[model samples]
Target: MTFASWQFAVFAAIVFGVYYLPPVRPFQVQLLVAASLFFYGYGQPELLPLLGIAVGGTYLFLVLALRDRRWLPVGIIFNLALLAFFKYKFLFFDPQAPALVDIAAIDFLLKLPLPIGISFFVFHNISLLVDLTRDKKAPLPSPTDVFLYIIFFPQLVAGPITRAGLFLPQIEPKRFSDVQLVEAAKWILIGFFFKLYVANNLNEMTSHMDFPFYETLQTQDRWLLVILYGYQIYADFFGYSAIAIGLGLLFGYRLPINFDLPYISASFSEFWTRWHISLSTWLRTYLYIPLGGNRCGKFRTYLNLIIVMGLGGLWHGVGPSYLIWGVMHGLLLAVERPFLKKFEGIKSAGFRALRIAAVFFCVTMLWIFFKLPNFDHALAYLAGMFRPSTNPNPTKLYYDLALLYSLPVILQHLHLNSFFERRLAAWEPYVYGALAALAYLEAGPATAFIYFQF
Candidate 1:
């Protein structure tokens, strides 16, 4: 279930309630595993067996890899294959066909719906195998612990993509007294506020940016919507990550922090470091470093950057737009690399501000590819942004509403929240309470999180 849903609210509450009971303390790991299974299956029970095979198979491989290093690559490939099959199988075969190969098992596997978190959990599996097997001295972890690590309800879906080395060790009996109630409440509240009041509301305006509808938007409106979409996507994904982290804290497991004011970043490389920190970290550690990161020559480093970024883009989905989005980002990084040192030497505030604006403008413009996944549509929209609209009728966007909804994201990137926290220390709790009220009151029409498709 989605984090914004009332169903999830009830589910989280019930799970939280039963989690800390005196009798349940010893079985905390098992409890969380069961709860996670239920949470995942709550929406798609049919996929539970796939989930089982993934985790169980990963665990089996982990054990074998610990004994024989050769098996590690095999295990990693196995997980990658699962990701490839579920994520890209549609490119090769049509699931809607009544019958294809005449093999019931293969057909059943092909026709099954894409599992919601396959991308995330497969990474978890790879990380688990790679991290644990790197040190052959490490003992084999129990199957249940591995299961919990792979499918913990909070991050089982869209993730901060926690690493095996970071998360596996934290699996232990959690104490109620140790729960960070106030901290957790703040995260959950801010998450809900951003998702509801900001992202969902902005979605109403940005929805006009889609296909035939965007063709009806005026040129200026198209530009306005692209910037608004940048804000909306950040709020949506950041909101989900925040909720995941807060829930992790409530259960005494700490997920990685995902975003750190990415829009304000002055460089594309810095932006990657700040935005989706976990995923970037995973790519660096697992993919980049192994491919001889910057340790290789300058030319190799540039090639590595393109390769990683291209694969990272493909990881999101199968499409030319996604590839272009990623490759363009890689190009930005490559182009900026030689000048970054000189740019960093500058001390003027105006220079810094200009750099930030330039980076943000480039990033925002690229998001059009994400909004319009069809390559031609993305080009058409980009082309429209540069020319006057010829359409007889244009969609009227409410600029006031767009500004109101996007203000939070703007203020947040500026770090204004820190100012209020320090100056209004005594009023913090009450301020949160008001925001909670405002979020509920202003919440817009529900939309599935943008990252859910990945």
Candidate 2:
């Protein structure tokens, strides 16, 4: 069920009603688990077994993690293998072709449907196993709680990717605090507003624009589109996280937050720290740390960073674009490390602002690759971004609203980036009000989240 649709609103209301009834605590937990299964299986009922297998397989992996430290490596390998089969079926099948025609044949023959948000789910499950490895003495939970946490519908698609250790333990009985409920309601509403009004509307700006026209537009306009895209995605996705975290709270679960005003960061490292905190934390703890992290030599540290970030990039999609994206960040991180010390004492305000602008521009450009379907398409889009203007049919309302819409991010960047960097907490009221209004607004047709297909 899409969080943007009335289906989800009604779903949330029913869940909330049951959750508030004092006698429904334990049953509500089980009901949520069942609802989650229905959510995942509702569309693709044929593949319900895949979820069951994942749950059973993960449970088994955790069991092994407790047996021997070596099993941690083995279990992870198994999880990766499973992920590869479903997520990388196209990649795996590529070599089976004798001709380009054979590629079509293979895709047809495989009949594999990529599980919705399989990437997010795999990472979350992997994190659970890593947490087990970290605390050798951590007691195993009832499989039900772990199941509930992992399969919860809200974060199942695009995620905050809450660590099982963070959420699973919090499922105990407690009265719903009024403040928490109100806060939860606010987040849910904010998520709806972002996904619907801001992100959804901004998406409409470019949806109808022909590629030929977009390619010929002035640099300023193309750049505006790109910036708008970045904002739309952040609002849509981070908003989803807010709703998910809020819903988790409604049930007495405190999920870790996903975003922290990422645009405010002056550096890529800082940006990752703020954006998708849960995924970054997962990569840092499970992938980076396990790969020896910075504990090894400087060169190895750089290599490890690249490897993790590259995998992190690939984790978003099973494509060459994603691979290059990961490698690009890896290279950027390596270059930034050497330059970090020198830039530390550069106290010139103008210079700092310029540096931030350059980085933001660069980052926004890179997002073009992520947005595009393929590498060649991205190249064409880049050409459009820089090319001579043909018809400069600027989207005035889009431009106006986009700039106005991103004011919060702008303020946060100023405060957090200083002279521009604003503390993330200051937007609390806006977040609440936006979400509440979203909940009250009539939900139009359901539109799937971009990441859900991953």
Candidate 3:
């Protein structure tokens, strides 16, 4: 279930109450783990074994950490195997492949429903193992701590991808701080505005311009969708992140900030440093650096960056589109590497704003690669935007263009960076109270978060 939905709000309220009660203190972690499992299973009950088996086995492996750290590799491999089986195996070969006729379990494996947050869970667990191995100073969290770490519902679906090292230590149920409570309220309100007002507006517009209708739009109508789409996804995702972080604060936990006005970055490297900071960092730490980071020669570093990002792209889905998206970002990162010096001097308000707009548009253009099913569809949509046809189109909502343009510049600029920090610094309880109310009123249909599908 979506955390932004009424059902999830109800779930969180129940969990929150039970979590803080003194009598339930000792078992709170177990309660959370159970809730996590229940939450994951609520929509797709059939995927229980697929998620449970791995989670349980990983728990066991970690419990045996002192005796056999060696088991970590085996455990990760086993989890990856499960992930491959359920998420990636069928995606490897197209349905039309001649080799498909020889398979027996192909139908079962291919058609199996994916468990929500499989990638997040598996990767977080890997981080746990890596921490245990690399930073021996790190203490292994209690079973309950570990359980809560994996199960925290906010980031569970589409995540800022919380880390055990960061979250497990905050396992105890503490009294709510007035300041944190207030910050949570601000987050809830701001996030609500973005999700409901900004993102939804763009989404409605884009829904009209989908494949069928998209091919027939006039140039002006076509560009309108691209701009709207860009705003829609940005608002949708970043709005979710803000709310998640806010909710974390209400529970007295601090989540790492996710967005940093990435569109404002003057260069591509700056964009990577700012956008989806969590995933980028995760990939760098776990995948790139280990594979031979910049310590190698320049060319090797670039290769590693491409490889890391390429796989990172594939991590999003089992399609060439995602591969292209990943590669495109990688290439952008590569080319922009040497141009940072040129961009560093862009400081005037007018120039900075223009740079942000340009970058935002560029990023939005790439987002087509992320949102569309394939390159052909993306090209068609792009084509439609530039060349109008008399053919039919989806319910295009050009009326929302003015609102969408103001989104990134006005609403989005509200939380550039250190937003969480600034709220915490303010430390007012009323903020969180306001947030709780907003979350209550802005309830969605309880759709699973977009990232959860990954």
Error of 3 at 224 (Å): 2.0
Assess every candidate by TM-score.
0.99, 0.87, 0.85
Candidates 1 and 3 compared: the better one by TM-score is 1
Q: What's the CA RMSD for each of the models?
A: 0.9, 4.4, 4.3
Q: Provide backbone clash counts, one per model.
A: 0, 12, 12
Each model's lDDT: 0.93, 0.73, 0.71
Q: Can you write out model 3's per-residue Cα lDDT over 1-454, one digit (the tens) per residue?
A: 7755678789888887777777876776677778878888887887777766766777777767646678777777876787777678765656555555466676655666677788888887777777766666776667667667766766777777777778877777576443287678677666775676566545656665566656656677677677667666667778889888888777667788898777667666778888888889889888898889988888988888789889988888878878888887888777767666777666688876677677777787877777785778877776666555676543445474646434543544566335655757565455445444544564333333456678
Clashing pairs in 1: none
| Model 2, C-alpha of 52: deviation from truth (Å) | 0.7
Least accurate stretch of 10 residues (summed lDDT) in model 3?
439-448
RMSD of 1: 0.9
Sorted by TM-score (best first), the order is: 1, 2, 3
Candidate 2 stretches greater than 4 Å from native: 92-109, 177-179, 208-213, 391-398, 411-446
Model 2, span 336-442: residue lDDT tens: 88787778688887877777776677778778777775777777877766666666464443567666556544654556434421454676667556545654563
Local error of candidate 2 at residue 31 (angstroms): 2.1
Taking the tens digit of each residue's C-alpha lDDT, what string does model 1 give over 251-271?
Answer: 999999999999999999999
